[model samples]
Target chain A: MKQFSKTLLSIGTALAILGSAAAVQAETIKIALAGPSTGPVAQYGDMQKIGVMAAIDDINKAGGVNGMQLEGVIYDDACDPKQAVAVANKIVNDGITHVVGHLCSSSTEPAADVYEEEGVLMITAASTSPSITEKGHQLIFRTIGLDSLQGSMAADYIANTVKPKTLAIIHDKQQYGEGLAQTVKDGLEAKGISAVMFEGVTPGDKDFSALIAKLKKENVDFVYYGGYHPELGLILRQSAEKSFNAQFMGPEGIVNADLAKIAGDATEGVLATAPKSFDQNPENKARVEAITAKGEDPSGPFVFTAYAAVQVMSDAIKAVGDTDPAKLADYIRKNEFDTSIGKVTYDEKGDLTESTFLVYSLHKDGSKTPAAQ
Target chain B: MSEASLYFLQQLINGLTIGSTYALIAIGYTMVYGIIGMINFAHGEIYMIGSYISFIVIAGLLGMGMVALPVILVIALVIAVFTASTYGWAVERVAYRPLRGSNRLIPLISAIGMSIFLQNYVVLAQGSRDVALAPQISGSWTFGDPQLFEVSLSYMQLLIWVVTVVCMTALTLFISRSRMGRACRACSEDQGMTNLLGIDTNRTIAMTFVIGAALAAVAGLLLGLYYGVVNPFVGFIAGLKAFTAAVLGGIGSIPGAMLGGLILGVTEALTSAYFPSEYKDVVSFGLLILILLFRPSGLLGKPEVEKV
Candidate 1:
């Protein structure tokens, strides 16, 4: 009876060991998707989240990289830098090695160091400030282009294509807005198109009549606003109300349906510069189709880029055969992975090797159409 | 007129438009302070709530088939006023009334707390993003030639100015001629004495909040309509500016509040036009300091002799 009891205990221990082994083999790879999931800019974060979800769905359905399932965790930074650092710490504490996130530059710039120090691979989906990648962090990579490219493209279009004599450059004076505005100003000056007035306006200011009145006196033929939609919409409306008729343009920050809803008729004929959306490329039809089938809008500025980010990271993990963040970052930096958005290749700065910005005009119906080349 | 003069006149017009909205809100601050001797820091939140009420009403009307502009305006105004007044009464009952016997600091802190609470409550209920409304009023009338500087006024601005004047006149008449208005004045002068005389000073104070909140609602409604956008935090800056106007005009004087608001608005507009636009706020605040230095009682405030 004693021998039988001992034998039974040994068998139970053996079964427990086997179960632990199976659990180890079936472990899911955790990926963190952090952004402003709940604030004023929640819509922007949702676009990236939707894109990441689509990629994860596709990858897992096809049997995730190396037969391991990819599990995603969402962290809300609310586009706040302080909260983003906390999220980065949380991701590191959770032993997460891969991340595709931090939609705004304000959040991304600070969070990048935390991930880099913790040996985590990060791919920011939408932060465009040149300063973000300019630090040359080895672990940081972005799927989207820098504001420098977009700003210069906007200036070039304004100088050569639109060919206005005098321009007024206005910025919201925040980090992203001011950086983009300064770059555009420099680009315009290089082309000998000096702005009549370059000024900074406080964001969330309801009254721009005084500023509009000043701009009207300058009689500038063009107005380039480096801000998000709310203030831009107000500027457009107040300018129109004051009879300060000037062609208005803005950066990607102005690319929102809410702009039209706020500016109303003033939104008509407005132009903005943005990276090529997925819907614009014929090669992305299949990818776009799958994304839309998931009840998500695949046409947003970040959706395709976000998808590309996830795809590149997943492919790198497959190439490395392990979840070591250092190896994954090195692999991503060295390889040119084909993605739903296009080819993904990085420069030494971890930004896209080549990026293009296109000008889109607002139609009367609040939809944007790419301008004819 | 020269182009410069036309430009000056145009800026003045713009200032007056914004000034009228400030005046509407400033009255709330002044009136509440007059009777209660409390700032009613949450008065701005009342205005914000009013804007939200107007926004919801208009959206609801639009959803209910094809609605005409005038009908939408009337319904939105009535509903916004009623709802905002109720909020004011409730806020006073919950935040201020309990702390009435406490020192001034306690009630002041309570008012600030209420302000923050209301701001966050709206943010949670609505959203942090600005709610965009389609421009309901359009078509501006221009006064100058196309070649020279043009002074243009939109139909919305005209409506704002007219409504402000009518409201101001009505409030003035109510204060001087009405029995309730006299009771309010008596409470402001001496709440203890007024209470002793069977005037129901508490009721009068509550009424003061109601009146102030209603006036702020008008400001919020017109502000949303004029700008075509409203947000939860609109009250923070607007409230501060209105407070400055109230203090500049004479804290408890209705006429002083109006004068202060107009002065603040026009001065800000002119400064932005002539100097760097960033300094416009500085000039407005500077005017407040200057007014206080010369006449501490405010522009239209009566001199106060301290009774020993």
Candidate 2:
């Protein structure tokens, strides 16, 4: 029995050594894909995943970066702030030095602190809250434009193009929603057009009749909703049923095809300011084809931006010749790169130098066309 | 109608529409608690499953080019009720039946566990993203002047009202007249005595679950089409609200659930109309607290008499 115990111990030690040897020889850099993989907004996480996976696949196919293969490790934050912080810690503990996402702005802001403090490099592809980049973290960056920029663009369009007599502003009372609404309100006030009514609606509410009645009573000709698609879809459909004749607009959060599914014909003529559809870029034909061939959707606004995040990370890593986040952050801030979202240049605050938000009129058939600007 | 009246009337209509659905879900809670003296916490998830089943059935029928709306609605309703009823029976059998007669807290904990299990089950089966179905009902009847304000009764709202009234009437009649309903009443009144009298108390208890589940399924189909969106987590809040409705109406009283649902819905709508919409939940829940503090037995609930 003593001899058998000694043999078992020897086998365990040998297997441990073999495992370590294999891990050491792989020479892979792990990029953590952290986002909502199990909540209401998990579809947005899927968009980030599609973009990151495609980028990783293409990078590895071309002999990798700095002779090291890129690997993606997924972490589901469920789009909750607390969960994102936990995921950030898990990624740090797992020795992943780079992250491509913490998708929702509310989730991203908290996780950004952890990544910044830990000296981890994170380039969020979708979170647009300006407060994220405003914190001035050295290792934190984003490929998406901020809500302030998008809000200003929406204000510009509403003021200059689709001018109306009386306006109403409604928000879902969430951080992302309320912040964007405030920005748009500020921009509109600066333009000398004030909303007749400014109010908040609960996020998961299925009833909007009372709200609609108030909008009609207020005689608002144009309504701007600051929230994700679900509530706005119900509002739109309910508004249509009541024959409310107000023009409606929202931000990129309501730009998905699901809006049309929820609101049906009411989605027609609804305006949204979203990042220019990067999947349709003529330069991204090959990448788009590759993603589509794998039966994945490439049309989400975040898809190319997430792909750009991976590209920038790899390019910086290649230029710096090491996986050190500080060196990579320094290189990324100073250099320019061509990506699926077009030429990218970062400001000192790590936000894009130029904005990409544009106004599009959604149709019932789930297609969007650039509104006359 | 004057503009103020029109607005108030519009809010009332909206309130009643939402209230009726809450009443439907509340019945499941009230009936289950009445019989077993334990809250069926998983009742809400059963409603959610009903929504998913209806969504699936509708999507399938639409995919096969089934454009006849009434036919599709009927088929989805039948399947959702049947499947959700089965789930309701299974939950009671698997989670609550074995724990019966144990410490009341044991069954309560088992109920919570069952709730979590059902939620995760739906989440794993259907991805957590919101699945939207195109609004199947459209158009409405508008009243008052369009220039000042319009009070509109949507066709979907009308359907919800009609279905809810019919279900409530049928339930009232069944409970008052049918042999199974009498058995249910007997079990609720005295389970031990009912069993002593050779009544299958277990089957009666299961029937209560099945009946409550069927009503909830009807509600699920109605709201899923009304809102045109469903997610696995949607049930949690809806369940909570319905449970609140059940408690406020007198936890074990059938009519109390209906009254509580209407009052809560109207309170929410009026609060949103007058005050900020964000405070609507606070106002409704605040009303519940006031009721609990003042009328501990609920508006219609009889005071319990403990046996010596």
Candidate 3:
């Protein structure tokens, strides 16, 4: 009996050594895509994951960076700050030195802090709130334009182009919505224009008739809404029904395809400020096709940005020939990369060095066209 | 008219439009509470189901041909009422029936679970994004000149008021005159006594759910028409507001619920009009607290009396 036990112990020791040897031989680089993969905003996460995975797949297939195949992991934060911090710990524990995620600014802000503290590089693809970069985190970067720039650009466009007499500013009373609204308001005020009415809305509210009635009473020539598409769609539809004769303008959160579905004919001529169109880049044709071939829509939120994020990270790793967070961060800050979304470069603050925001209008057939400048 | 009065009048019209919906949904809560002595938390999901049904019926019929607007509304209403009532009946049978004899907390908890289940069920069947309905009802009537804060009332608002008035009258008569409603009242008073008197108490309870569900369907249809958008989570807020209305009106009293709903709605509209719109919900909830403090039995609720 003792001899049988001894034989079993010897076999287990041999298996353990063999497992270690096999693991050591496996040359793979691990990265994580952390975001709200579930919950209400999950579509955004799904978009990022699709773009990141496709980029990773193309990279590894073409011969991985320095011959080390990339392996991706996903952690769902549900856009909650606490959960995002927890995911940061998980990624760190798993020995993943890089992250491409945290779609919402609220989640990105704290998770970026954790990543910075833990010596991990995080490149969020979609969080646009300016404070994300303003925090002075060396290892934290975003591929998207900040809301401050986007919001100010929108104010200039509205004042110079649309040129309405009076405007009403409406926000969904969230940090993102209120921040964008305030920035636009400041820009508008600087341009010697002030909204006749400013209103706040509950995020999940369906009824906006009362608010619509107020807007009608004010007789504003334009309504600048800082919220997501769901409420914007309802507000626009209700406004049209009441014949308010006011044009609607919103930020990128209102660029969802579902806007047309909810607002129907009302979505026509609805204006929004978004990052310059990725589809317009002729160089991105092949990349878009590759994403579409994977049965994922390339036009989704952050699909191109996420692709750029992965491209920049992988290229930086290849350039440095190492995955040290500080080296990669410094390398990214100093270099320019031609990506699916155009040439990308970052300032010392890790914000995009050159970001452009444009105005787009929704067409009747559920497509967006760049509005006349 | 002065701009202030005109604005106040417009806010009043807005309040009544939303109030009518809260009133309709509040009836479900009051009626169910009257008979079973438990909050039908799933009542909101029943409203949501009704809205989805209306959306399907309207979308389906609109897809078929160019039907008259009135015809489409009637057809959608009939179908949504039938379907939503069936759902309400099933909810009671499956989630609440077996637990009828259990502790009161069990049934309340069961209703909450059923609420969550129904929400996720809709999310699965329909995608989570807001489902925008085509503008089936449009146009409005202006009460004053557009130059100075005109008080405009939309056709949808007019319809909501008409429906609420008609439903309230019909429901009052049904409770006062109908045989089933009498059984419901008796069951509310004393279930054991009603059973002793040969009333089918179980059937009455089920019918209560059916009736409340039908009212919720009407509310759902009108809300979709007014908003032109519906999502799976609509029921949670609407249900919460309606429940507050029911409690404010007196939990077991139908008239109280209607009054409570109107009051809640007007308060929300007025507060938003006069104060920061963000405080609208806060003010409404504060009103609830004040009412509870001044009158624990609510404006019309009867104080509980124990007998030896």
| Tens digits of lDDT, candidate 1, A1-373 | 9999999999998799557645864667878999988999999999999888888988999998898888787899999999999999998986788899899999999999999888989999899877887776889999988777878888888987888877889998898788889988999999888888888887768999989988888888898988899999999988877777899999888988888888888899899997786766888787788878878888778887888888998898899898898888888778899997778798878888877478999865679888855
Superposed Cα deviation of residue B139, candidate 3 (Å):
1.7
Which portions of model 1 show Cα errors greater than 4 Å? A1-132, A135-141, A291-303, A306-339, A343-345, B65-68
For each of the candidates, the C-alpha root-mean-square deviation to the true structure, in angstroms, is 6.0, 6.6, 5.7
How are the candidates ranked when ordered by lDDT, highest leading?
A: 2, 3, 1
DockQ of each: 0.65, 0.56, 0.58
- Report the C-alpha lDDT of model 2 over B1-308, residue by residue, as the tens digit: 78898899989999999899999999999999888887999999999999999999999999999999999999999999999999999988988889879999987898889889999988899988788887788888888887778788989999999999999999988988999999989999999999999999999999999999999999999999998889998889899999999899999899999988888888988998898787889999999999999999788887778977
Ranking by DockQ: 1, 3, 2
lDDT, residue B278, candidate 2: 79
Q: Which stretches of candidate 3 lie over 4 Å from their true place?
A: A1-142, A286-340, A343-345
Assess the local accuracy of residue B128 in candidate 2 as a C-alpha lDDT between 0 and 100.
84
Docking class of 1: medium
Q: List ranges where model 2 is wrong by over 4 Å.
A: A1-144, A282-350, B65-68
For model 2 the local lDDT of residue A176 reads 78
lDDT of 3 by residue, B127-179 (tens): 88788777777778877766887677888899999999999999999999999
